[model samples]
Target chain A: MQQSQAPISSSSAVNRRGLRPRLTLLLGGILGIILLLDLEPYATRWLQPGGDIIFWDLHFPRVFAAAIGGIALSWSGLMMQTLFRNPLAGPFLIGITPGATFGVALVTYLGASMGLEDSGTSFALQPLAALGGAMLVLSIQLLLQKKLTQLHSLLLVGLVLGYFFGAAVDIITQTAQAQQVKQFVMWGMGGFDRVLPSQLILLGSSALIGLLILLYHRHAFNAYLLGDIHVESAGKSVKNLRLWLIIGSASMAAIVTAYCGPVSFVGLIAPHLSRKIQGTESHGPNILTSAFAGAALTLTADLLANQLIPNTVLPINAILSIIGAPVVIFMLARKD
Target chain B: MKTQRVLSAITTLSALILGLASCGEHPRDANKSDIVWIKNAYATLFRVGYSGTDSFLELYTDAQSKKIAGAFHWGTSAAIQGYEKLKDRSKIVSLSAIHTGMLAELNAHRHLVGVESRKYIAHPLLQEKSTINSLSEVAPDGPILPEKLAFCNPTLMFGTLSSIEDKQAIERQAKGKFSVLWCNNHLENHPLGRAEWIIAFGWVMGKAEKAQGQFNTVKKDYESLVVEAKKSAGTHPKVITNCVYNGMWFVPQYSSYVSQFIRDAGGEPITAENGTGSNVVNIEKAVGLFSEADIWINTDLCTTLNCLKSSDPRVQHIKAFRNGKAYHFNKQLQANGSNPYWDMGCIYPNRILSDLFHIFRDDLPTDSTYYYDICK
Candidate 1:
């Protein structure tokens, strides 16, 4: 057991390099908070135990939900990208968001439910339907994982399923009157403000628990990036790692989609931005950085949404596309 | 680089929504056949129509408006044709300002450019449009030109399909790439159902929150009046509604909002059932229902028993006409034969509800009645 001194030095250097991502995370958090508080009735009136109704109820919940949404989506994206060994793997791309959207379309189109609170022993079935839809798609993908075997086939199936669910949503919208199925289409438009103040608890706790699971297993996630043979040779259960990855990402993505509608660009763009900043494939730093970057991007888009026209909040999803689309196009079209 | 190529591929794939489903039959028309929920007021309150595009992107790219609320009144006509959300305040034309008080909103339309107001306005709106346009023209757009935004008034009850100027303007503006804002309040047969139309008006006026508040207050007052009237010591009047016009007596059905108003006001309404709109009765049934009546309402043609006698000498046997308790919603009748009751009445159902309450029980000051008038 001759320990190479070079390995020791490399490990120390890695710890020192970790400081950059931590600093970046701090800055990102600061930016997100500042943006959240920057809007009108602008002041920290939200701290006064219900001073301003606008701040206490509307803006704070929306901004906080948006931050959590960014983190969850980016973390979900990181998990998918690393697991698939592709930067493009996002929760939306693999049919999860579309599946949740499909559930929303069905719920709203049928007029079966829309968050009836006073009906004791009842909960809003809309979010649950969305969660169930995401899980259904993930379970199907997982089953296909056993049969498809190849990673490319898994990705392809995900792509096809995404389109399939999207069309299901399309058919749903087409069938229902524009007025009858208003909420059905509203789900697809994706809004941070759509998260109910009551749901903030479930959304926050569920997202945090999922993130903790990811953070706790970041080592196994890193091992997962080394491929099945490499992961097994490294004394890790590849199947277990892959299962956790799918479960963790699916739960977070499903939860966020259930709350925030179907957000885009945050997840797909976050990991790439993190990798650009950190320049490492290590899961621990990348996960933290990706979450921060996603939060920052989402908060920035939210800021633009509020400020775009006076007294109007543009759709957060549309703003994200306007920002993320160009960034992605630039990255793809770039020489390096 | 490999990253660049992979990233580009991902970007293209990310933008794809995979919209390849077989179209489904429009269910809005089927909502009428629903029979149960269709009668529920909220079901017809608002709707977001599709039929315009697979996605609402048909307007998304051109207009900077968001479809915050789809203010639709599901009527007895065909399915609503387009997806229309009036962009808040900024896009509302001034002609319709008197009803929704949109002159306050005229300040938001900076680049009102030119409004193709010729067909969109009847005489009342035309009177208001010139003043509104001059006031709305000063705002500057950095790069944008004036848009051909047309205003629609669906208040003309005698107007076809609850929307006239809009359908005509739609054809003309469709060529010029203009847009129209619509309200179908006339289709809502309930007074409050008509009044809830303010929420859509508020959306266009940039005071949707305020409209909702006003409506909530009105609803609260109306419901409270109903509760109060329940405690009053009075026998429930057997109320017959409407007069015979063109050899048929059309009365508000049991399911009609007018019937709901009468019932809510402590009156036992003599009416038909299992339908919306109005119920048509043959002469025999009409005479039979009216013979049992203790009160009569919604008579438009008769102000006096002699007038009622002249229209139909059969009025001599009517219980309400003999008792002198007959009422008509002709108080808001203007000099031009166009009544404000149809337009302004829907904006304040509490008033109408109160009027009926007073007619049935006599609590409110008689002179305070805004829509209903007692038959002398």
Candidate 2:
């Protein structure tokens, strides 16, 4: 699976790869320690013995979900950027997260209109709603790609769809009651700590499965990076590969968004960080490196958001944007 | 590509199916005349109210409902309207926010199921509606779910009908056959006018005479409190409200009902210069207001001064915080976070006024506050 247009010599590339994985492991260890030790005054019970209910119910799920969700979103972002050959492309930048948002809006608003806004059943099915919304956008993108020759044009379609879904969400928010609107707004702000203990395993497994699929097709991604001509000459249908990649990436985003809300930074920033650190376009190393980096960033962000105020939990998305926006700009500037 | 098309088509179809499924409404069935209505505060803002066999009551529209919902004294407008309209007000089985002004009325009718705050729960006169049946032991953990309310099996649901959850419950249980009176009480700007919602409540319950009579006493008591507050010629304490939630500070507008209480209690309220609704400002601006203010109220459910300070240490710099004049509207709370101060506080602005007057004036012998507790 070695690239024909490789920039670095084989020996140097191998040595760099060996060093990057160790750095990633070190970063992951430091992040894990930060997350575990940075408990708020009220969350002290999380570390005490016989705190199973507290740990399993209140704490572990959130930390695990944040790490897993970050890995999934970063992995998806890598797949998206590689497939589109566009550095800026990520799930949230396109319509995938918005599609998930739309699905939640559908359930929330439609339920509100029918006078069932506060029903437990409505909240219980949020993951399904998110998945449906995500699938809707993914399907549209797949269908449109068949006719449109340019991938950048496809990016335009995703942006437009994002706006359409966003508008729909706003309209429904206006019609819904104050409490219901508040719930939706909180969900939109995005947080990792919202996942329930019951949902942790399901979300973790889905993310793991998505990560495995990406790992298996690491060679395919390398071939696609070489361009569609290379991939076609290798007897792989570029069209089918693109479709599968979209599905895989969109599914990861949708699942994480459904469980933990629409996180921003991991999907867009982590992949860039991976490529920068690895200094190569190889999917194998970049994929693992991005996942580890994404997890570290998210865990650290979640810790800050949780403990920034003594009693109040600040929105995770707000903290992520504060962190992610500058990183993206810096990357663009450095690339420039 | 063929496989991709097939999968894409399937995904679209699945989205449509889910969309349609979510659009489904819970089936409701009930006879309007046979059911009684229970209401939350927000639902009282609409013009129309409940429908019964003998009447389709238009709450805010009718001259009587309008007059009472306009009045600030709890049950006063209802009492006045009941005398003119000649209806029994006692049949209105609505949850009362138990406060001083309505204590007499509520005590007189022990059948009424009131949502008492923790302070009022200990009141000697707290109504003992058939303890086995009248009281809903299932305290709803969050916003009143339809099921918790369904236990009441209300025939005439009185509210603004704005909450989709409440609407669905009524729809499913009553099957579009029950009466849902729109109570637009929150819309009334006049302190007395906001209290007059009892007239609408009276009409629903067929207890006009009792509602009117009860409201008259509240009017008299509330007027006397106002008269007492008017005697304070000293400087009006600069008042601020609410603490930060999720890093944003929300202060009520000058036109807000809470500000009206501050004004009536002889205190100057700090509000946003513009906007008729709550103003969302950053922490720095909110802290500036807090530091400058003489008194702070409604510290976002922070019952203790320590809770307030711990949430934001900058609050310690406020004059109100140093003077121990910071108060919370959470004088009464349930373990589940339900506070009747919200439910009944609107019905008795005079009590809230009395509470604020006590908080602001050092000259006056401190009166027992009904809805506020000094955060210390």
Candidate 3:
């Protein structure tokens, strides 16, 4: 009955040529101009001989910190997007940032409870503790991988881990000294200014190594687009590759989270923007594009954080959250 | 497109290099030896008196022609003592420093190269100088221009005990580069220590005789006050320091500094079982211990009568709150014109003793507020 009723039909489809490289370059140029404009007054002040050297001195360190931090965050975002293969997957989604925060909270609050003479030991020990916490969560995800065939199952597990970590942090904070609690609250607000020159090597190298690793495995990532079984049939050890990718991504995410406090949504939004621009989900193009875009976004946000108020700086996370949340919402709504 | 990307990358690299190079122009005459000296006597004294930990003092005395700089973060009293013993201040050419009130007393305000925090931007000199909130915020090249520091020419620098994280790093930064002295205050660090450090600072600033006389007066006055408190011991009431706020009640540990004052004033102190540590107790624990505490004292000087009246809601729950027996000690009383309360209290414990006696003993005299409004 259906064979008799069948009719041939044709619909016109638009051919969109690749112009993303030029577009990205144009956007980067615009952002650079805006940054220069925002920074001009300080430059002029610094150039003027004997015109408040103190203010000029303060400005240099802050600007350097912001630049370094922007680069690190952007690279971290690119690596995470490539590893997870989920458009919405970011550092915050995997609970790495929260896990790191839990580590710092444990050190600052719990260390105070334990009667440690040196308060700085808490800060010194936070990165290693955070790395341990992130690994723990990663191991849990790996154990549940067989049962958690669906992405939703993995996400739900991550959300539960996040909640568990948050509850533990709150309990530790309650027992801590009021002064120590105040210090933790201030740290949690997240500032690029906190990144010292000494920490730059550690943060910068880890992010670079993670991005390089992701770049080397671009072909495997492209195969991942056809789903796990197809890639497995193509003679690649998909399980081992997936584990390494997760470890690399989680390690990068965990370090940034530990050092800079939890920065949200950059990983998710940057890759999505890159994919939309490329008009294909090819790993090679997406990774490079996402890294550049992430850096640009973070740098611009930091510029706003510093310049929004004349003499004061807002938290880096606050600026990113304001810009990121709406874009994510728009992407989800458009998909729906 | 690839060529353009390369060109843009080069342009960005060149810009960054230019920016960094511009930052590198060191201030002229940036050597530590070039600045005017205020005193050099403290060097002679340290060379003679202190032999236990020569690691710190050796930095000041044995350095070469190159200017050395180190961060000092401990021993405020010891710093004061060392400085007071010093014969000259002029040898100290630059200082990475803080604590404006103490700086004013030393009269070495111009030597400040950098400040540790912006919390005291309200201070006139710091308002005019560069300040960083945290040491971790310092740039790789160091925030202060060597030329500016050279003009100030400080050979040695000092700070509070908490500011130093790595003494070795500080020494490395200053060893053959600058001399660093660690200043720790006795009252903050030690439970029962003297104000010999004031003499130390005087020695550093080349004011040894003035420091000696000031130290003597403080010691003599404290002894007399102790005797006065003892005179009216029979009539003295039971007292507690009430140092901590516990939501429902004021908590007073028997081992706190305030407890020492209460004991010296001839009052029986509750919470004498708690040790000398500044541990905070819960409201429940505080209430259980001091359910019948007669007097509640608020030691915070920044809060005015109105501010305290509004902020402290728990003040209404305790027996002391019901009786309106709360009193505040004025922080300004610790200062004599420009000198710090630390110097005042440590040197003249008698004045504090006298104040405590007046509060506890009905026959003793006190200020009008403590007399008519507070005790009654």
TM-score of each: 0.48, 0.52, 0.45
lDDT of 2 by residue, B178-273 (tens): 344445566555566677656545544555566656556667777887777778637888999977532346678786777877887888989865
> In order, what lDDT does every prediction score?
0.61, 0.65, 0.52
Please give, as one word, the docking class of candidate 2.
Answer: incorrect
Q: Report the number of the highest-DockQ candidate.
A: 2
For model 3, residues B36-125, the per-residue Cα lDDT tens digits are: 233322122221122222112212322234222222212112332222222233434222222333344455555444443333223333
* lDDT, residue A228, model 3: 75
Better of 1 and 3 by lDDT: 1
Best by TM-score: 2
Error of 3 at B91 (Å): 64
**Model 3 CA deviation exceeding 4 Å by range:** A1-14, A34-84, A114-119, A142-152, B1-376
lDDT of 2 by residue, A1-336 (tens): 444333223565566867776776776687668766644432665445434444554456677788888888888888888768888888866699999998987886676455343223445556789889998998999889898878788889999999999999877776564445655675687776556667778777767777787777777777888788878877788888888788778888889988777888788898888777676777777777888778877887888776675334577888999999999999899779
In angstroms, the error of model 2 at B348 is 1.5
Model 3 error, position A78 (Å): 4.6
Q: Sort the candidates on lDDT, descending order.
A: 2, 1, 3
Candidate order by DockQ, decreasing, is 2, 3, 1
What lDDT score goes with residue B156 in model 3?
56
